[model samples]
Target: MSRERRKHVVYITKNSEYHCRDRECVAVRDRRSGEWLREHSALRGRLIGAVTAQGRLLRRMRIVVGMRLCLEGAGDEQLVMTSVVRNVGRPKKSATCAYAYQSWAGVIGA
Candidate 1:
C-alpha cells in the first residue's frame, strides 16, 4: 500500500541542518496556518525548504543522514515528517559529484 503524503514545516538552516522549531520571528508567526515561504524574510535564500513526504520516503531520507537528525524524540518526532540531506556543510566546497551521488545511494539499503 502506498503511504499517504504529509506536509512538514522544515527549515533547512545554513549549516544544512534541519530545525523544526519556531524562529520566533515572522517566519513562523504571522501565518494563519500551515508552513510557507515569506519574501525578503528570515526564510529567504537560506535553503530550499518546506517539503512534503510519505512514510517510506521519510524513512529512506532519515537513513541518508545516518539518522543524525537533531530533534527530540517523541515531542519533535511527530512535528517533522521526513528529510534527506548531505552534510557537505555550507557548499563553499562542494562534495564531488560522484561522492555526493554515492553518499545518497549508500544509505538506500541501510
Candidate 2:
C-alpha cells in the first residue's frame, strides 16, 4: 500500500509584511490584500506562527516588508512556508480561495 501525498492550500502574499505579535502568535498584511491573516481571526494563530517559523528555518532570515511569501498547508496540519523571495517584480497569481477558508471553517467548526 502506498500513502497518498497531502494536498495543501496555498496562500500567496503580495508585498506583504510578517509581524510576530508574540512568541505564539503572528499576523501578515499587504497593502493590496489587506489583513488576510490575523492572530485574532477564525484562522488558527499557530498556522501563522508555523509559517513564520518555517520561513525563518528554511531561509535562515527574518521576513521583511516587500517580501513575497507562499504559505501552504491545511487545517491543523504542519504548515510550510514554501517560498520567500524579495523584489520579484510582478505579483504572482493569487492562489488563496475564499470558499476554501469558509469550507474549512465549516468542517472544523470555527
Candidate 3:
C-alpha cells in the first residue's frame, strides 16, 4: 500500500494588501499567474534534521499554520484563495533557504 501524498495550500495576500516575508518556507509568486512557488532547501533541510529526531517535522511547523506557500514542483497545483494576514512567525530552529523568499513575502497568518 502507498500513502497518499500531502498537498500544502498557502494563502498569500497580494503585496498591495499585506506585505509578505515567506517565513514558513521560502516562496515566490508569479507576476501573471499568481502562483506561489515554494522550497525548503530543496526539501533536504527537513530530511537532514529528521535524522537526529530533534526537529524538522514539516507538518509541525508553526509557520505552516497560515503560511505563504507556493506549490512545489510543476503542474496544476494551485491555492484555493488568498487571505489577508497581519503577521507571520518565523521558525525558531530552521535555517532560511538559500533563496530565502527575498523575492516575495513569508507566511500567511496574522
The most accurate candidate by lDDT is 2
**Tens-digit lDDT track of model 2 for 12-32:** 344453332221213344547
TM-score winner between 2 and 3, please give it. 2
Q: How accurate is candidate 1 locally (lDDT)?
A: 0.28
Q: Give lDDT: candidate 2, residue 105.
A: 68
Backbone clashes in candidate 2 total: 0
Poorest lDDT segment (10 consecutive residues) of candidate 3: 43-52
Off by over 4 Å in 2: 1-13, 36-75, 85-110
Per residue, candidate 1 scores C-alpha lDDT tens digits across 1-110 of: 67534322333332333322232111221223322322212321222222333322222232233333323223223333223333322211222232234335652111
For each candidate in the order shown, give its overall lDDT on alpha carbons. 0.28, 0.36, 0.29
Q: Any idea what lDDT model 3 has?
A: 0.29
Candidates sorted by lDDT, best first:
2, 3, 1
Task: Give the Cα error of residue 78 in candidate 1, in Å.
Answer: 4.4
Clashing pairs in 3: 20-105, 20-106, 21-105, 21-106, 22-105, 22-106, 23-106, 23-107, 36-70, 68-107
Q: Model 3, 1-110: lDDT tens per residue?
A: 68424333222344412122332223434435644334422221121111112333234333332343222222233322233322434322222332344333444210
Steric collisions counted per model: 0, 0, 10
